[model samples]
Target chain A: MAARGKVYLIGAGPGAQDLITLRGARLLAQADVVLHDALVTDEMLELCPRAEKILVGKRCGQLSTAQQFINKQMIDNALKFPLVVRLKGGDPMLFGRADEELRALEEAGIEVEVVPGITTALAAAAASKQPLTKRGVARSVAFFTSSTAPEHAEHDAIPDTDTLVQYMGGREAIATAERLLAQGRHADTPVVVIENCSRPDQHIRRLTIASLAQGLGAAHGPVLVMLGDAMKTRAHQHNDEAQLPSAVQQLSA
Target chain B: MAARGKVYLIGAGPGAQDLITLRGARLLAQADVVLHDALVTDEMLELCPRAEKILVGKRCGQLSTAQQFINKQMIDNALKFPLVVRLKGGDPMLFGRADEELRALEEAGIEVEVVPGITTALAAAAASKQPLTKRGVARSVAFFTSSTAPEHAEHDAIPDTDTLVQYMGGREAIATAERLLAQGRHADTPVVVIENCSRPDQHIRRLTIASLAQGLGAAHGPVLVMLGDAMKTRAHQHNDEAQLPSAVQQLSA
Candidate 1:
């Protein structure tokens, strides 16, 4: 009997190739096949030059391979190869649709190892030099998808937390903001929408939840929305110019 | 005037030293002063031999340095050296309390570069081979801290999500579960608790949210709790007999 192939679901971090974990890099180097997502950078592909690369990406409004089909392809390939790398943007486990693939692989009886990466939520916040959790400002963090199903929206309720980070929210920014408001979230809630995070063209906009829709008109590309009292902290700090150091002012500008 | 020092807020990722991002490792190698958390492993310390390694850790019950004091130390040390690494376990923007330090550095007219790391929330889920999000299973993911100040309990509420990862919730497992239940989360919500994630003695337990507190009794060390419908997908796939090729499983296992 041939050795069954193994699959490594690796997170590629936000965009910077160097942001990838050493373990993820090692796994990519050893992989026989590399199946990557849309958000993965080309530099990440360079890490697995020996591996057969397959672009199994899903872009909004584009005709893409079904996720189930992708998972089956990975499983089938793993059977022939000893190592398969499912490289994803951000952390594979966090909103990366890794579970379906994991189930498909596990059901096929293939062993899977997951190498975690820096998710966009943290990367965006880090890029902006904002702490997702500040002692006096934000005590909790909430994550949701602006790409939610309409039925789920009508039936399910939004959870409340000090801070909220919405994934895949670029197109539905207005609807997401409205739903958040309907959930009793503050109208004046601070919102930071980061688009193409960690990339050279990364763009960030600060707005109130009430004005998020208006702000989205100016935002280009995929977005991750951060909302909470911590947003207020940025404003307060921005107003305290007397305390701000020159360097800090330059960075903010 | 001497060149002002810079601070690199780097996330160390989970316990495995190799899990650290390439940028994080490079920063560590170049650090002049490395102020690390308790959760950082000894293996991670090896990357920064030239630096003055300071342990500024805060355990759940142990006496710890105040965040303000840590900020002061970082500022003071950066003044003496051109490079300081405020090394944190996982991504600095996440529960790592990076905002306070970043604010302090900026306020002092120092340059700060944030290099994100693989957070424990994603690492724990990956280690468990469970997906944090699954198609049709979970559309959103949330990371929360169950560890809270006693006084703030009155106002703090655990929000609902497709999946929830709770950091430092071992001590408050019962209270955390109860809080989630009170928030209308189902009692049978699947929950996976990982202790000392990515470390040698890593332990994982899968239970329902209702039974989580009682199920986890007196377990010591850091704990990460993942709860959601996506977790239930694991149980459904458990009975499937599709086994990976034996050789691959043996090597990976």
Candidate 2:
């Protein structure tokens, strides 16, 4: 029998291959079988040369792999191989629906170790030159997702904080901003809409809360909306910085 | 003149050397000088073979490096070296006070590139086998700290959310819980206090909001307090896992 296989649940980080930790990379290199989400890039798969790569796509309620199916595959793979890796887009511990997978795995007597990765919010912040938490300016950071089952809408509303980072936030920016405005959020709070963070073709648009509530044009990739008074920066950075089309020329935070 | 050095604001990850990203490790190996925080381990320094390693320790309220001093050193080193790394404990974008350094560097015409790292909250969530955000259970997650200067106490109150992770939250656990309770956090919400996350000597304590409001004894390392309704579990998980004294013995999230 295959030595009572164990599972290593890994976070694939934002997107880049090198962005992954040496620990995560090492686990991928040794895994007998690897099951990854759609967000795990092709370049990352190149690192797992000998492993059988299975794509369990999870794109938040669209045409994606069912959570139940993913869980069963993980169990079956664990039984067949000594080292089974379940790699999620970001960290497996945050909004990754890991509870169901973890519970079923543990019930089947499969040991598990979680490998945390850099979340999308952290990556977007870095790519956009924004700080999630700054001294005196922004003290706390909150993360939310706009994609929620219809039944869970009430709980999915964005929370009030010094900074807000929203994942899968593409068409919901207007509604989210309005909700915050009703809750007394500043109308001039700086807003940053980033599409496809960390990847080569990244686009960032900066505006204010009032402008975001008005609406935005279509975007290219997965969207993350960042809003807070702390996001305001001088419109004209030094010439050495990128001269993006939608650059926000304001005072630095 | 030497090449105008750029600062690679790298996150060293929780406590483990292997947890640092491959990008961060590569930058360190190529750095001419590395200025790291107190939380960065000596093992990480060995990654920089020929580079100058300076410990700019920043333990909360302890005798550590001042921000202005660290900023000055970064600027000074950038003028002389080709690569200067500011190795932080977690992701430089989140609560890393990177804005100060980034602004100072940009003002002086020094270039900067940020390489995100896994934050301690993500590590604590993984180590305790808890998820930061759940589907129906938790729709959002927030991060804050309790070590605020007296003048900034007003914004220090806990924000209402499904999950809360507090950093540098040592003796102030009781106050933080009380503040949340006062803000209408359920008295029965689950609480997990982690000390020295992701390290071999890690310690964890499981309690309820009521008990946490009563306070905890002194701890060994830096503390991370996680509280929310989503954290409620069976209180005792299977024994096959690590046998830490206060380990959370329940199904993983």
lDDT of 1 by residue, B119-211 (tens): 888877777767777767776677777445677764576766778888887877888888888888889988888887777667878799878
DockQ of each: 0.51, 0.48
> What tens digits encode model 1's per-residue C-alpha lDDT throughout A1-253?
2688878888898877777888888778878999997889897788998999998867644333577678888988888998998899988887777767777777788877777888888888777667788876776787777434576665656567778888877767787777778878888888887888876677777789889856477555568988887765542233221232222233324
Off by over 4 Å in 1: A60-65, A154-156, A218-220, A233-253, B60-65, B233-253
Candidate 1: deviation at residue B53, Å?
0.8
Q: Write one digit per residue (lDDT tens) for candidate 2, span B33-69.
A: 9999988877778889999999885675543348778
The reply for model 2, stretches above 4 Å from the true place, is: A58-65, A154-157, A234-253, B60-65, B234-253
Give each model's whole-structure lDDT.
0.76, 0.78
Candidate 2 lDDT tens digits, A123-183: 7777777888887788888988855555555445577678998887778778877888888
Report fnat, model 2: 0.68
Give the DockQ (C-alpha) for candidate 2: 0.48
Model 1 CAPRI quality? medium
Tell me the alpha-carbon RMSD of every candidate: 4.9, 5.3
